[model samples]
Every structure is written in structure tokens, then in C-alpha cells.
Target: MPAGSPKVPVKFDKVQKYFGPVKVLEQFDLDVAPGEFLVLLGASGSGKTTALRILSGLETATAGRVVIGERDVTNILPKYRDVSMVFQSYALYPHKTVAENIGFPLKVRRVAKAEMDSAIRDAASQVQLGDLLDRYPRELSGGQRQRVALARAIIRRPSVFLMDEPLSNLDAKLRGYMRAELKHMQQALGITTIYVTHDQIEAMTLAHRVAILDRGVLQQLATPAEIYNDPANLFVAQFIGSPPMNIVRGGLEGRYFLTNGARIDSPVGGHVDKAILGVRPEDCAVVAPENVALKGVIYTTELIGDHTLVTVEIGHDKLTVKASKDIHGNQGDTVGVALRREHLYVFDAASGQRIR
Candidate 1:
């Protein structure tokens, strides 16, 4: 393939995987656009990694099909699938120098020595490892080793890139830095990439679209903003946000949601004996009890640098509210939580599906 050639799309058509009687992927269907970064996000055993592994030809589907662009590659060998993978462990050769490791893929294909060296240099420079080509993996930092793995994957210039939590091994600071780096590199390469990670932050920051899975079933597939703002169901609403979305089990009466001796005005009015009220932390504000919708006592407060996370006790449940740094409150202080009717999400308590 020529450099900068138009990338190809990846498709999973009713893809299913099973280990004996347990189904790991339940008729999963997704389409990844050309040059797009799609992140598969879920907690452990959610089948996110299994989906990626199937796409990369590391694992075969028990049924359904895997297609890469115009071709059906359901049973193709990993090497023949024309895709490269960067693993979570930064699978670099400990004894091999950076140059050797980066060039190993090209070398396996029997590229000319001169051409391989040029490609290695270009890939190394792209990742800012040009000067460390002669150093071994043991001599480099975690981030540097990850870069080597990335460079090796990129050197192939494959149609697709599979990344399985490639930044999970790095420290918090390093992971943030590398997330930016990975985003930039993927844009520069314009390759179809499927990234698997359990971290919502990574999925939110890096993906053009996020596919959220739960227990082998795909819950939602949409852009990060859409997923965060308009969650399809209770699982999506609860899984994507920091501190998670506050879900209060209550009853819907007339035009109000009744919960914990408090009633908040609801835009969607209907009588339901049981319903779930969803709201993000940032959507709730601490305000004077007389002007607020619901009142609660402060259970605890956490200073998270930019803002303070205030947990308020509402009956038996606690709701976290993101308060401005300038606001200060102590435990046991009675405070009011102001919630906007527009920001409140309503879900069916029985089905865990959005009411809207």
C-alpha cells in the first residue's frame, strides 16, 4: 500500500464468540469507518478485548463473520489479515535494540536492508525515538518501551491497528501524555484502529466513537459526546462518567420525581411507581435550601484540585455533586442540591432503559 492511501473500513457482522457453553460475544455488530479510531470500552469480562482479538485474527469467531474492507477475513491467519497489534504489556524484545524491534516486522517480510533501515528511522522519528534506536528495552522507561511497540506496529502501515490497553502499564502522568501522542500518531497515519480499554477516560478522550459492552453484549455505539450526553440506557449512563451518574430510585408523580423525602420537577411527567432519576455530578449544584429543588446533608467532601466533589446524603443513598473550588462545605452540613429539569435523565427502573 502506498503511504497515505485511503484507509479501509472494518466490519463485524453478527460476530459471536463462545468458549464452550459461555458466550463471550453476543451477536456483536459494529462498523468502523476508514481512518477512524473506535474504542471498545467495558469492565473486565465484558468481551471488549475478545472482540478486538477476533478482529485481529488472534481468536476466531464461533459464528458470524469478520470483514476488513471489501474482503471477508473471518478465518484468515493473523499475518494474512494485514493488521498490526500493540499489546498491553509493551511486547518488545528485551535483548533487541529499539531499531531492531521496530524493524522486526519489516524484516520478517524480507524487505531490503536499506529500505527497512529507512522505514525504521522514519517510524522512530515519528514517535520521538530516533535518538534511542540503539538502546534496548530494559534501558528505557515504560513510556519509551510503549513507543517502541507503537513504532513496530506503525512500521507495517497495515490497513488496521489493534491496540489492547497499550497505555495501561504507564503511570498516570505518562498515560495522559501518551494518550495525546497516540491520538496524534493515529491521525497522522490515518489507519483504521480498534482500541480496547476499560478506562472510560481513554475512551472519552481518544475515540471518534466508543462501543460500550456489558457481559458480551454491546450496550451502545456512538461518539464520546453523544455517549456521555445522551446515554442509551442505564448501563451507559452509569458507566461513562467520572464518579458515575447518580441514579436515585424513586417514584414519578404528576410532574415531579419523588425520592428520599424530596421532590424535583421532571420534564417528563407520568406516574410510575418505580423509576430511576439520573443526573451527572456536574449537573447538580450546591445552593441555598430555599432556592434548590432537593436538600441533603453533606456526607463527605473531596478536594480534586480543580473542583470539590461533595457527597450528600439523601435518605439511604449518597449523591455526588461537583461543586466549584470556591465553595466550601463540611460533613453533616445541610445543603440543597439544585438540579435543572433539562439535565435530569429518566429511565425505566424495571428494564434499565431510558424513558425518553
Candidate 2:
């Protein structure tokens, strides 16, 4: 760990939030290890931002407790909690120079000028903004402005770092670069960080562990590989993948899945009137139409650099098969989809739970 202040664990016990009659978070429970990067991931209105606000003391939880390093901070003032937040909007003074913006935190605390200047230089160096200190916010680029905001946040090195989609405003290429910068800074600072983002790529690449939420409820919390390979339910299965996992409605018969007029073998055995079969694009292949259990007309073929995604229309559903880069196919070509049984995921249609 990088040399810094002592790191402390954070906990949420039965946290609940409500705006009038609308429930945003219901008995939210999570534990973030000391000096760990945890990402809260979900779609819009999924209660991710609500939870972060609650932790930051900006929005109080309707019930439960928020603990930081064994201190009950649920009712503490936001400033008193010793946490710094980085907002999606670059919250910087337009007239303030980079050094002034970074040193503003210390200025508020009335630190000595010499100590404050030293801290500002240290923080700016961490974010690679040492050369831009004399420039005003308007003189900097989007990424530079973001780095200034980050420097302001880390200038204090509080117990925990709260970042709410800090990179969302940047373009794709810049976002990628900033993600690397954020990860490196966090590791070097050894600060406990809670980052919130709806972008799966960000969560997957940056978080030590991702906590996926939906409608104020945490669906699953696990490493990226575990969450991808063994999703807790249908929501996570569909949400995490880039192109999303393909779902086929079918009936389960013993160890087989029956869709349309075809019967396909599954790894898990179960009998149900309704079932959903999920297979990722990378786990499926396009084959000759006559020999497979599922055959359909190719709806479209998308060449995505490294591979070709062939979407086959099987009755009412379409399955995207990840084929080689050189694979050739037309829009209306007849093709068969071969799903690897070991990689298939079966979900109970009524409950949305995975069938192990």
C-alpha cells in the first residue's frame, strides 16, 4: 500500500431511503474493505446515486446506519464525516487558477500558506497536473478540469473518496485514459474509494468488486469475472455483457430445453413450463442450418473488428453468435446456432432466478 493515513472500513446496515411514498433504497447492506475500490453500478433510477448521496451525508437515509471506520456517521454533517466527493460536473471555480482550485480545501481549513502550497503541489503531481497550475479552468481541457477536481478532492486525503461518475462527461477515448489515471491515483493514495457509474466497462475495469443494484436493491456484489461467469439472476446476466446476453424463451424438459420445434440439451436438469436460456455471444457459434437444434434466418451480421456478430432470428427471438473476423454471411442467410452447453445459463422465467 502507498504511504498514507490509516485506512478504515465502511459499512451500511439495513440502509433505507424514501422520497415521500417512493422507495429508493430498501434495506441496503454492503461492506467496503479498507483502501478498496468499490463501484456501485446500475441503470438510471436504480438508486445508485441515492445510496452514494446517503453515504456522503448529502441525503439522509430514511433508516439504518452508515459507519465509517467504526464511527456512526449516519447523522454527522457532511463536512464532519471526513469524506470528499467528486461530482460528475467539474465543480471548479471558473476564475480560480489550477493551484487556487486545488488549494481551496486547505484554504477553507486555514492551513498555513507554506503547508497549503506544498499540499497543492503534491496533489497536483498525483493527477499529473503540475504543469497546469497557473492556468484557469477555462484554459484547461475537459480532462484537465476533471483532474483539477480530483486534485481538490484528494488534497485532503480524507478517510474515504466518493466519486459520482467523475469521468462520464469525457468522450470515450478520454474516459478510457482517465480511468487508468483514477485507478493509479487510488492505489497510490491508498484511500478507501466508492465510485458510482452506470457504465459496465468502467465498473468492470476499475472496481476491485462491483455492487450491482436495481430499483434500490443490491442484486449482486462480486469480482468482475465471478459476476460475468456466474451472474446471480437475469438482470445481471443481461446487464453486464457488452452486446448483452441473448435470451431464448423455452420449456424445460428434464435436462433438455425445448424451443420452437427443436430440443436442445442443457447442463442443468429441471422441468418447468417456462424457462429462459441465456448464452453469451462469445459462447455461441454459427453453423450449418440442418444439423443443429436451433436454426434461423440471419437477421443481420455485424463486423466488430475482432469478430463478427451474426444475429439469427429463431422464431420470435434472435441469438447473436460471435464468429471469426473473416466469417461471411448475408442478412437473410439460413444458419444454425451452436450453444456450448457448459456455458449456458438457465433462468426460471417466473422468478428470474438462475437454475444451477
- Alpha carbon deviation, residue 225, candidate 2 (Å): 0.7
Give the alpha carbon lDDT tens digit for every residue of 1-356 in model 1: 12644699999999999999998999999999999999999999999999999998889999999999898999899889989899999988888999999999988889989988999999999999999999999999999999999999999899999999999999999999999999999998899999999999999999999999999999999999999999999999999999999988898898989998888888788988999999999999998777876888999999998999999988877889999887878899999988867999998899998887
Off by over 4 Å in 1: 1-5
Q: After superposition, how far is residue 278 of candidate 1 from its true place, in Å?
A: 0.8
Clashing residue pairs for model 1: none
Clashing pairs in model 2, backbone N/Cα/C closer than 3 A: none
Error of 1 at 77 (Å): 1.0
Residue 330, model 1, lDDT = 86
**Candidate 1 lDDT (Cα, 0 to 1):** 0.92
User: Which RMSD does model 1 reach against the true structure?
Assistant: 1.3
CA lDDT of each prediction against the hidden true structure:
0.92, 0.93
> Candidate 2 on 1-356: residue-level lDDT in tens?
11355898999999999999999999999999999999999999999999999999999999999999989999999999989999999899998999999999889899889888889999999899999999999999999999999999998879999999999999999999999999998998889999999999999999999999999999999999999999999999999998899999998999899997999998889798899999999999998988797999999988889988889999999998889999988989988899999999999999999999
On lDDT, the leading prediction is 2
